[model samples]
Target chain A: MSDELYFKPLTELAALLDTKKISSVELTRSVIARTKAVDARVRAFNSYDEADALAQADESDRRRAAGKARGPLDGIPVGFKDVIAVAGQPLTASSKMLANFVSPYDATVTQKLKHAGAVVWGRLNLDEFAMGSSTENSAFRATCNPWDLARVPGGSSGGSAASLAAGEAIATLGSDTGGSIRQPAALCGVVGLKPTYGLVSRYGLIAFASSLDQIGPFTRTVEDAAVMLGGIAGHDPLDSTSYETKIPDYRGELKKRKGPWRLGIPKEYFGEGLDPEVGAAVENAIAFYRERGCEIKEVSLPHTDYGVGVYYIIATAECSSNLARYDGIRYGHRSKEARDIIDLYFKSRAEGFGAEVKRRIILGTYVLSSGYYDAFYLRAQKVRTLIRQDFLNAYREVDAILTPTSPTPAFKQGEKSDPLAMYLCDVYTIGVNLAGLPGISVPCGFSSGGLPIGLQLIGQPFQEAELLAIAHAYEQGHDWGERHPKL
Target chain B: MSAPADLNIDHVANLARIALTPEEKAKFARQLGEVLHHIEQLRKVDVTGVEPTAHAFPVYNVWGEDVARPGLAVEAALQNAPAQRDNMIVVPKVVE
Candidate 1:
């Protein structure tokens, strides 16, 4: 009923729904309207389904009125990154290879959200096969940053982060491989979580890098992130890698959160490449936490320097294998008039994959090939073990680690044309994924250029509840979340 | 590291099943060298006697229950393929 519905926190929305101050249908309608108003300029969503969203919201309203409670995400309108399957809907990954592809069943994450009574608002855009750091690699139109359309929203989950930043959707699901979730979240000035590997099921989500990919939520606030995470964070029989640990009440603990928490600052994070403005903002965040009675200790993660190299090998190798199924067989994208099966394979992939994707796939296949595996892929995996050990040792002495999420603020679109240049932007983030630890990017401050800077918090595997509590406390202590883009 | 020209762009292209123009091969050779050089930084670290782990954490095997589950129908499976013939996807002859 109020304009505040788009800006209200998820917990507040849930409370209003519980007290019937705003009907589920009304909330869904309002969000749908906001999305229509803003998305034309933002290009955040690849597919918008107002009829389905309203129908689901009506169902949620009926359930609530009948006193049949589902979960915390009840009546919330959330968006799905296009790569994720949404049952009987398209799952294109924004690639021509899957242009007409429709999923037969919901992905595991989608099933969980639906079970929690959340309305599936629409499908947000993403880079093709989640390949690039910027959504510019998308075979579809690029997703613009809400703050400044000329600058990029960090990518491949660019649209997911942009949608949340523009208030088009209260929350959206994003898949992080490398820094897909964190980078975009930082660029768009939103809260994005990259849950520890296997913490959430990847069964229904399209594979980017099987080992590196983890689906998480992007929201405007820390509390909203916790609430949305609660709905989708548990074991699923269909996804073998799903967590077996108990799903804690993240929202509840965050509400009563008090901190004397130990925050680790890895010396490796504040190194040569970090921009001055970004570095100052992170230091300020650490000082803010120190004032909140949280202990700050400088820690070492020696293998941090090798994180990008190791992750690239492991991720690309897995991508080569995972994407092998798309060789003009089974489903999606087949080349016509091929001389034979092999030519069909060649032509299909040649026509299907974009430049960045081709580069990774080639590198991956080369590393995993016979005679090269021991030298490249095997060596990278060995280093990956060392990277994980670095985190294990650091966590023994700290509750969570804080660092700058990216080396620099959002660069102008096309500034990083060289693939390696783009890859370096993930230097701060790759280490966490290689260690299989949970990480979140929270807006810390704005650069002198008015672009946002993000501070990352890395937690041990399955420790999202503690992570959220710390982030919630930090959000309250600082006025960062109060800031919004001038779009 | 191999010379930029000696990087076997053709061999890599064959393995990746991508057709590349000569210009593309030359261009990618330089790009791949740059990336490989960046990757060579990992070689500086001492990883002697360390056990290799493909997964970040230890897990014997992560798998779902082996049960027959409903899948998309045959028609649905081939719906998106650009070229299909006789209820099967048509591709170039695989055997040389």
Candidate 2:
């Protein structure tokens, strides 16, 4: 009974909660208790208020009992990445810079979740300022992969995935900037989706790279991810970047598996650094699709090699500008020893920012510097257009592109100390973001070490529903979605 | 790769307004040089006449009704301030 309740998909839990078969408080407690038991090793949550969670859960129960349950997420518990604001709650973004800072307002997504009747809980760990590939860069603590305690859970969204892998949360919200959501979701063996850029509001998500950053969901199934996306997606007047498009029923197409859909296999993704086991598993998935009357074709995204270089230059350039707000005056840490304004700016930032963040900031400042702007940042932006055009060109030939989410399965924590090595982990997933295309990472198989490997599907802009359907077709054909980590 | 002599790490740090210790300066200089070396690969692509995409989706003049709306209270806004005086965020004196 405990196992059944703890790992139940968000959709299943929603149904159970609606029917009163299990109360929200019970479900919330079970997840909280499970987190306490396993998070010592998984290190998923940075902070969780049990009393606050219970109160929300208890309130949800009363509302449901009165037949006044809110929306689909009513009575469900969802965790938030530390970057997303929750009113009066810690919004650390996993850095010492904002270690003691609390949000003054609820983020649009948070407000949406509350309106949906979901009990918001937990400040999930992330790379400090959402800047690194591994949660190892978090100033607070590194989150561990539930599949293998020694391996990283992938990152930026590492804690979101780790929490789900260990059954700590029913579902989670993670932000993707240069594959922060999809890469971690792939590494940790859960279903995660990054909607087409601007589909979800970014009003209160602490900016890392404004252009590339987008908020999405992590769940155990494509259906749950679709449901989570539906609850949070739509135009928000507060976020000027939020897409002004009709929000469709994201789960409507999950049930439509009518065949003969075209899937593009990018030759670039299967190249060097791909582990043989992971390649074979995605290959198997492709074959499974082919036998079901689907057409699989080889497509070229020729500018793929430039994705990483272009992404770093562009992402960091924007990051340096966005992060300038943390000047230690209005909010966050201040240097106690500074004798003047200039001294304070230098000391507080040096003391507060992490090494990875500092490295990116310096690089960003250099790229945008007077002599180098045309040579680096401008050049990268031009290349970024080519990279984006490559996707636009590919989608004309096929309905979607399929690739291995990461080059390999999860690696050991601290295995990659080279910053470039860490950046390369997002190679397969970054270009999709550059093009503003929607993409998802769902478990395809496991490696010899029992770590999960993910297969990604990229869809055309504003077609997340169709994207979810294709993922659902593959997910329902296999038991990958059902396999939970043996915590 | 050896560090580039053209760019001084301290100058860049000054541009970023973050003062690093001597040890941090040396370490950042070396590491930033390595990453810049990696990023130099972008120069190989011929992007002549390619329009730079600052955003994937272009939405313009996203105006809203300009009216006074209730915002965070003074106390709430100042909740995270490092120092506050007279219910205002206190900072170093900008003028004599």
Write down the TM-score of every candidate: 0.95, 0.98
lDDT of candidate 2 over A1-487, digit per residue (tens): 2356779899889888888999999999999999999999999888998999999999999999998998669878899999999997889999999999888899999999999999998999999998887899999999999988888899888999899988999999999998888888888889999999999999999999999999999998999999999999999999999888999887876776565689999998889888999999999999989998889999999999899999989999999899888888999889998988888999899889999999899889888988989999889989989988999898888999999999989899889998888998889989988888899999999888788989999999999988898898898888876888887
The global C-alpha lDDT for each of the candidates, from Candidate 1 onward, is 0.85, 0.90
Worst 10 residues of 2 chain A by lDDT: A251-260
Per-residue C-alpha lDDT of model 1 across residues A1-487, encoded as one tens digit per residue:
1255876667788899999899988988888888888888889888887888899999999999999968668998889999998877888898878877888778888988999999998888888899887798888788888888888888889999988888888789999988899999988888999998888889889997887889999988898898888888887777656668888888888867687899999999888999999999998889899888889999999988898888888888999888888786766777775677778788888887777788888778877887778877888989988999998999999999999998998888888888889988999989888878899999999999888889899998888988988888878877776677776
- Runs of candidate 2 with Cα error greater than 4 angstroms are none
Question: For candidate 2, what is the total of clashing residue pairs?
Answer: 0
- iRMSD value for model 1: 2.1
Give the clash count for model 1.
8
Model 2 Cα shift for residue A165 (angstroms): 0.6
User: What is the TM-score of chain A, computed separately for every candidate?
Assistant: 0.97, 0.99
lDDT of 1 at B75: 82
Model 1 misplaced stretches (Cα beyond 4 Å): B1-6, B61-69, B74-78, B81-96
